[model samples]
Structures are given as structure tokens and as C-alpha cells.
Target: DDILPDGFTKVKPRKTRRNKTDTTGFPPLPPPKSQSETSHSTASDSNKQPVPNLSVTSTPSTSQVPEDTTAQPPRKVRVTPIVLRDASRWRGVNHKFISLGIKFERAVAVDAGIRIIPKSEDDYRRIIRLFREEEVPHHTFPLPSERNIHAVIRGVHATLSEIEIKEELQQRGYSPLHIIRLKRGGGVPMPLVVVILPKVEKSQQLFNEHELLGLAIRVEVQKNSRLIGQCHRCQKYGHAQSYCTAPPKCLKCASDHMIHLCPQTEQEERKCANCGGGHPANSRTCRFAPKKNLEVIAQRRNVSYADAARDATRAAPSVGSSANTQNVDLATALRSLQQIIGPLISATQALQAIFPANG
Candidate 1:
């Protein structure tokens, strides 16, 4: 048995190797350090955070954000609304402006004013600036009325009275309306050939839809006037068709016998080749012998071919007539047989009397 001294019986602890802090009686640990504090420290000092041990692992710290460095905030711009005024009543009109319920786009300012002159001028520039933009010039003008009087009078269709023409001019914006007197006669309707002349300044400033319309009316009237002298007799121009001096028949009628020729009169007259007479070439007696017989007969026939043809045509059955077989009735057959037998019996009796011994 292993014997121990009485004091040596207590168990002794293992001794560990000495650490760097063992002489100072403290445990070894990492130096406390931070990026911000290190950045604030002088470069000469070795105050940097300790580099992690090559073999040791460390828990990751929560993420940090850098301080903001922006100098100033952004600014917003202010916009004004635009409204159009004194615009041409006949000039340019916006579709969006007319349709108040539907929006064209976001609101934007636009320049608006009256540019047409003497009649209207700009008074609401502030409101005009609310529009986004102006449309391209259409160069359209308005129909004349009391407010814009004085228009050129164009020609008229159908029959128009002087009072009617004057009223039309007044409505078309004409001052001191003038009308060219229309010629009245010879198939042409009431035709006018004049235009109204407005004052110089206003006429010069305004566009010319009226003048163009007037000129067009004059042209149409002139063209129709030239056509009124046509002839109605021959259906040809230059004279009345009733009084046309063309041939007994027109060129077309003579060529094709169409139109103007009386159908009843034409059918009654026949065309002849031999004598050019309005009758058939061969007479009824001349055509009889050759058609009926090829053999030379002793009979001197008096009938003509034309007459025979006519007779044959009359004797022929109509379109839906039945054949000979359809006309053979049993009753008619019996009557014919009786008549034939009666004649035969009469002949036989006469023969018996002639030869009494044979009977």
C-alpha cells in the first residue's frame, strides 16, 4: 500500500503557464477601440483597434450609418393660369375650350389676344396666359350677320326675288348690298352676276371667302346660260329639239332603225330584193309546183308557193295540240266501220243480181 505523510494526503492543483498579464495579476483581453474614436486620434499614436487573432473568431457587430453631408433642400416652381379673350369669333376656336367637361391636358399658361384687328382687341392678357399653347392659324372667316355686315352677293339657283337676294346679303355681313340684275327668258332660270363691295379698310383686313363664293356662283350661271340655246327636236344642241333641221331620221336612227321610227308602220312594209317593192319576191302561184312534188305530173297546177306556205301555216296544229293517236275515239271508229260495211253490202247485192246463177 502507498503510504503518505500525514500533511501530504491533501490533493494538489495543476499549475498553468504564465500569461503576459500574470506578473501584473490581471487576465489578458483585447484592447477597447472604435473607428470614430480612432479617426479622431492623432496618426502618430498606435491607438488602432487590435487585429483579430489568426485562429480566434469574433461575433459581428450591428451595422452603422455615416452622418449626412447635404448642404441645402430642393425648390419648386410656381405656374400661372391662362385665359383667351377677344379671340376671333370666326378666326380660331379650340376644341378643348368649347368642351368644358373634357380636359386636354394639365393646365399651363399661354399668350392670348386679338390679332384680327379693327373689330376686336386684347383686354384679358392675364386670363389668356392660362392656356398651354395656341393652335396653328386656320385662316377661317365667319358668315356675315348684323354685327359683321357687308358680304358679296353670289348668283342664285331656281327663281329668287330681289328682296330674297337682299336679305341673303344682309345675313352675310354686307353693307349697302348690291345685286346684278338677272336676265329673264329662254329656258335659263333667274341668274345674277354681281358682288357687294365693302369699305376699303375692312375689306382689306378681312379674308375673301365671300369673294371666292361669289366668283364660283358667277361661273356656274355663265356655264348654264351657254347651254340654254340647245334644240329639243333632234335631241341635238344649238337649236330646240322640236325645231331641229337634221335629216328625216337622225344619224343614229337611220343607221340602226332605233328610236323615232314608228314600229307599226315599219312592220307592215316588207323588204323586196328583186324589184325593191314593199312585197314578197315570189308570188303564190310561182312557188307551188317545186315544193309539193318532185315528179312531173300531167296536172297544170294554178297554186302559188307563197299561197301554199300560207295555207300550210294555217293548217298546222297550234303549239300545244295533241297527236293523231290522241284523236282516235272508239265511238268514231265504230261509226266508220258501219258506214264502210254498208257500202260493201250494197255492192255485193248488185254483183249477186248480175250473176244470179253464182248467188
Candidate 2:
């Protein structure tokens, strides 16, 4: 029994220590509060503002950032390699290329025709070699319109094999195929494939789609424009696939195997071996293709139809256009004639005044 002292009612005993094993069990769960208590807690939560759910993380505060006193070395820049895709349209264009949407990066190193802009402008430059698909005819001065056919190829199979697709087309009598292409990200095959046909008859002609491959594989003609003249076999620019002499290469990777034979998995990131880029080798985001298109467009805008017609009349006998040269020559001759006749006319008028004509 606990002791009792004066002025105290009673004394209680202190709690005894429990066995360690007693605590082995899980801690007691929170008790279920009374209805009033739960309602009050809910009310408190409702009264407070909800935190915003943002996808982007908040930036660290300035004080949270660590300051480094160590000196840092300069980082080496990796320059993008570039090539001219449409070399045929490069004719008659003089001095430096420019495009609004298209950007030209300075070259870091020169590989073949690809070059980095040197620090010194006065440095003696060797002739820059440009890559081309087919041999451009020297006589093609005005530059012929490109020839190409755009078609949408729908596949019966859920997954299409690019190499086998050709075999199916060959069976359907679509012979001598020039170019076949699908969009990027070939992880799961798409139902529709866009293709280019260089042998098409007309420009911007629409034709009905035809089924081939003994399957529901059908090709519908879209727009027929000038061929971009890219080589599917070599995965190179400037020549047609049919005329390609280089070894077989992948369009997606510029690899040794055919584009259909590439082993690129969906999990792996796409990369271009041609330009060393994140996109595929055949991507228009490539430096070459867009640059060529800009050059073609710029040349077209610079050379008017009337100028082209006049150019066709004269076989480029001089540096300047025939019409301009003729106008300059005529102006010079008129000035010379005026100068030669000025003294004679003045002398004749003076003699008439001296003689007092009809006195």
C-alpha cells in the first residue's frame, strides 16, 4: 500500500517498465475520434488553401545554391556538319547562302565538302567540294523543275516491313521503284507510308489508290511535284536511287544495312550518323535538305520569269544577262553620237546667223 502523508489524500505508485517483447507488436492505431472532432478537423482543412499541383518543379532559392570559387576551363563547342542537298539549283547563285527559317551553322571541321568557318577570312581557301545526287547537266542553265510523285501507301498488315514492302510492290508490277519512305520513329509500324516516285507522269496530279501485295496494301497518289533527287540506296543527296553507285546504306541511320534491316529498337534514342545529330539521317531538319530548298527558292525569287525567258533566248555569251548588256551598249552609243554631233550642229547655226539668211 502507498504511504499517505499529512495534508495529502493519497500517493499513487509509478508505472513499472514493460518487457521489451511487449513493444514488438505494432503501435496502437489512432483512436476513432468523435463525430464533432472529425467535423472540426475537416472544417479546418477546408478553411486552409489547397496547394497548387504544378508539373514543373520550383526553382531553388538563390541562397540555396552553392558558390564555387574554383576556376573553370572553357568548354569545347561541337560544330554541326553540313552538306548541300540540292546542288543542281546552286547554279547562277553567287556569294553566301541565306534563308529566313533555315539556319546555317558555322562549320567546326572540314570533312569532304563539309567545313567549319575558319577564324581567318583572309586564309587561302581550297575549292569547297559539294555533294550531288545525279550528275547535273551543264547545259541545264535555267535549272529544270524537280520531278517527283507523292503517294500514301496503306498497309494491310498492322506492322509493315520496309524491305518486304518493296517485294510486295514488285509483285504488284510497281517496277523500278525510285524511292520509298516512312515517317520517323519506326518503333511500331504505321498503317500509312508516304513514298516518292520519280517516274511519275505529271506534276500535282491526283490519282486513285491501287491495292497491291495480295494484301489490302494500297497506294494513293497525293501531290506530284519536282523530285527532290535524293538517293535511297546510298542515303545520299544529289543523285537518284536508281543511279546510286555508293554502297547500300540505311536511310534512318546511314548505316551499312538497308533502312528496313536496321536493328534500332524503340527504347533506343534515334541518331543520325550522317550529320551526327539526334534526328535520323534522312530528316529534313538536317542541314543539307532545308539549305538546298532555300537556295532553290531564293534563286527562283531572284530570277524573274521575264529574265528567264530572255536568258533562254541568249546562250549566256557574257557575264551579265543579254537584255541588260544590250541596254547598256545602246545607251553608250547614244551618248557618243550626241557628243559627236554637238559641235557640228553649233557651227551650222552660227554660219546661218552670220550669213543673215533670206536678206
Winning model by TM-score: 2
lDDT tens readout by residue for model 2, 194-246: 65555545322324445555665555776534436566666556556543334
**Which lDDT value does model 1 have at 224?**
26
True lDDT of residue 22, candidate 1: 58
Question: What is the RMSD of candidate 1?
Answer: 38.6
Query: What are the per-model numbers of colliding residue pairs?
Result: 31, 12
Q: List runs of model 1 lying over 4 Å from the truth.
A: 1-155, 184-189, 196-198, 203-207, 210-359
Error of 1 at 330 (Å): 88
The residue-by-residue lDDT of candidate 1 on 1-359, one tens digit each, is 33477745555666885644456655767677798777667574566777767986555555545556887776632222222233443223445434533222233232333222111212122123223244322111221221223332344554666566666556666443455554553334454544444544544322344343343442221122222232222222233333222322221222223234524232244432223433322222223213433121112335565554566445522211133223435556788999999999999999888888752
lDDT measured at residue 110 in model 2 versus the true structure, 0 to 100: 27
The lDDT of model 1 is 0.38
Candidate 2 lands at a TM-score of 0.25
